[model samples]
Target: MAFERNTQETYYESIIRQGYSRRDFMKFSTYIAAYMGLETSAIGQVAKSLETTHRIPVIWEHYQECTCCSESFIRSDHPIVADIILDKISLDYTLTLMAASGHQAEAAKHATMEKYKGEYILCVEGSVPMGDDGNYCCIAGRSAKDLLIEAAEGAKAIIAWGSCACNGCVQAAYPNPTQATPIDKIIKNKPIIKVPGCPPIGEVMAGIIVHLITFDRLPELDNIGRPKAFYAKRVHDSCYRRPYYDAGLFAETFDDQNAKEGYCLYKVGCKGPMTYNSCGTIRWNNGVSFPIQSGHGCIGCSEEDFWDNGPFYERMTGLAGFGIESSADTIGKVAAGVLAGGLAAHAIAANISKRKELRDSIRTARENEKKFES
Candidate 1:
């Protein structure tokens, strides 16, 4: 099933054609607006854009990847979000989801590129292997590098879907035999948005797309080119066990009493303090639970070179700009020590006051006895 190009179709039109009512369209608009961090007043603007703006053509290309990004995307919390974005709208070419394959799939891709030149969105999901002249990954006799160059040549903007396409992921870790390279390193000319994660949350992906469609521009990005709305804070900043972290209550092991009590996982190599993502807030599996919530430490999958940063189960030391000397343990220990010292000091002061009062009472009693004798 090749997606037929309909240049005149708006997103709202596609939604209605897909059997959704106006109310459903509005609901989707509201839902996306909230996810995008838009104000209440902007809900109407988002809806208006979907109602008036023509669906932008999208060409999703996959190279050396596990296809987890696509898997996470299709399983978005809202069924309509997947339906409207992946199927009903302008997703003209995607090898994973499109029905057409081989030459038919290639043809649809080329058609959209030619028809929507400098107008279509290019979504690259995997890294390109620069080793062996790009022989590591190929599709239909074309090298991954060659495919990416051709597809990116005319794109309005490029969206690098996961860590693989953003920071080279595990493929680029260590010796990197394949020399897997992220898209931004290859295509420096185009504006690229890096949604870096092992597999980014489904709603975050949808929010990014809707943001692009609604505003006809890119969302406000962080210093590293991620959407600031979703990546503004570290996972530790929002984790439910943050109080435990601040209070020096840490789980020393995976099955310790502290772990069972829901203490902070920092001592056991939780990377939440260093990892900037919305996992704690947006969560996964339809906002049910993220990795930390499921009793595992954050691996900092979203940060650059996270795989090589350290061992997954070993705690990081001397993190800069975090707490005292950039160590959460240090902060917690110091806080605990200060509290204990204050209590001890208070106790000693009270004991001295009691002794002084006793002395004064005895002296008064002796004076009374002398007065009575006189």
Candidate 2:
């Protein structure tokens, strides 16, 4: 698998050669920087990096899961993301997107791996099935495990895209017949950046790539390996209906007047409070609306083992360590108690401040009267 070494073109050069204007390129850079949670001053830095840095060679592998991650990537809000970020990169191999198949596809992947060695990025899209000696999923007459190990050997970095690759997704859910396993567990000794979601938001996917391209390093990750910029905040923290939750207003059931009024959906099984994702902010379909905005509670798809957590429509109130029995009937009572306690503490503090102010006023008046008599 020998590849001719051609001059590697920078991302900006590729875009310009493809007929995108300079303005368009910089605008795309600014958009990427914002989504990557970079400071305002970093817009120029992003543009400069894209202008000079050679496009990263990528080998995208797919295995035992749906192709929704590819679907989401293609449907990014701006066509430039697909055109510049994905297309401009030397994407040597991807089972779903590459037109070449069979021997041609296998050749391309090997060529990139051999040529780039430890410089290329390995993007894995699904989990590997190890049940029955990895018989569950095979590609080109070889098990997925064999292919993944071969591809990952010389890669500089690995990206586990979507929940399937990150946490084995639903394939490894309760009573999993295929014994699907996540990439991190299979491949040790490599730092994997996990982008966990049923199919992560398109912009979020692009943001991760742009960060890698600009910084020449992986973005900061939380304990779970998800990028901190996107997974740092819970969906509930920024949810529009958070006010309702704080005020003890909630929808008991779907299609009720409370729901129509956009009250909190905690009782009907919203997982926003427990799930960390950028859905409430970055949103899907170009920031239009997410699941909650569409009148459905969060299913916590981003979290690991979400499928086995419980029924999707059932509120999980019997959580351990909260010292409270949880049920649909008792949710309102809990919310009310929290609100009442907060109000009482505020009132007590205000009374103490008011008494101190009056005491000071009387003491000052008496001192002034004594000084005048003297």
Candidate number achieving the greatest lDDT relative to the actual structure: 1
How do all models score by TM-score?
A: 0.84, 0.84
Query: Which ten residues in a row are the worst by lDDT in model 1?
Result: 317-326
How far is each candidate from the true structure, as Cα RMSD in Å?
Answer: 10.7, 11.7
Alpha-carbon lDDT of model 1: 0.91
Give one digit per residue, the lDDT tens place, for model 2 in 19-88: 8899989889888889999998999999999988988888999998798998898788877888767754
Runs in model 1 lying further than 4 Å from the true structure: 1-3, 317-374
Candidate lDDT (C-alpha), each: 0.91, 0.88
lDDT of 2: 0.88
- Number of clashes in every candidate structure? 0, 0
Residue lDDT tens for model 1, 148-208: 9999999999999999999999999977999999999999899999999989999999999
